[model samples]
Target: MIVIDPASAVPPFEQLRRQLIDDVSTGTLAPGTRLPTVRRLAEDLGLAPGTVARAYRELESAGIIETRGRNGTFVAPQGDAALREAQRAAASFVDQVRTLRIDPEQALALVHAALRSAPTAP
Candidate 1:
């Protein structure tokens, strides 16, 4: 379940996006699982439709989900070569971290730091 903390420093849309990404990556949300419509999710989370739409758009752009016109959005199948390679790299990283006995929180922090320092695409 996606929880939005009004008190959180992070924006609601980012919270939703991160939660959905984690769910998809961890297999908590299986491939082909249908996601709630933007309107419905916004209502359920007490957020604006535009916020949910923005999250959805970002996820779709990242190849994490797909929208079927009139049919609704579902988890994207793991067919993209780039996505598959990324998943493999992530799994390998996790294994290496585990072998080093690194705490998950610290590992995630390292990832966040790296992402922040990385250059953006043009």
Candidate 2:
């Protein structure tokens, strides 16, 4: 399931994409889990079909999802190398915080605050 906010600074497609990525990374959505059809998901989320389609395309290109014609989209199996790459990409964000002169404690506190403020899973 996905939610969209018309008032969000981020675009609807990016929100959808990031949510899917988070789900996949956290294993809430396991590999090979089928995604709803674009139209259905778009309607459900009150977004344009094109928005969902664009998100799906980007996910597929990033090796996060795959489409099998009529079989629809499913989460891709993230191999060891892909997992390593994702981890490295995530680490770079921390490096950026360091470059900005943020202390480790402050950085960790910011992360904790964000985690605390995030919506709880259903």
TM-score to true structure, per model: 0.67, 0.66
Model 2 agreement with the true structure over 1-122: per-residue lDDT tens digits:
56777887788898898888878878888888999999999999989999999999988877888899998999988753246446676698789997899989898898789889997632
Model 1 CA deviation exceeding 4 Å by range: 79-122
Q: Tens-digit lDDT track for model 1 on 33-104?
A: 999999999999999999999999988877889999999999898854246546776998999999999999
> Global lDDT for candidate 2?
0.83
| Cα displacement (Å) at residue 4, model 2 | 1.4
How much is the lDDT of residue 116 in candidate 1?
100
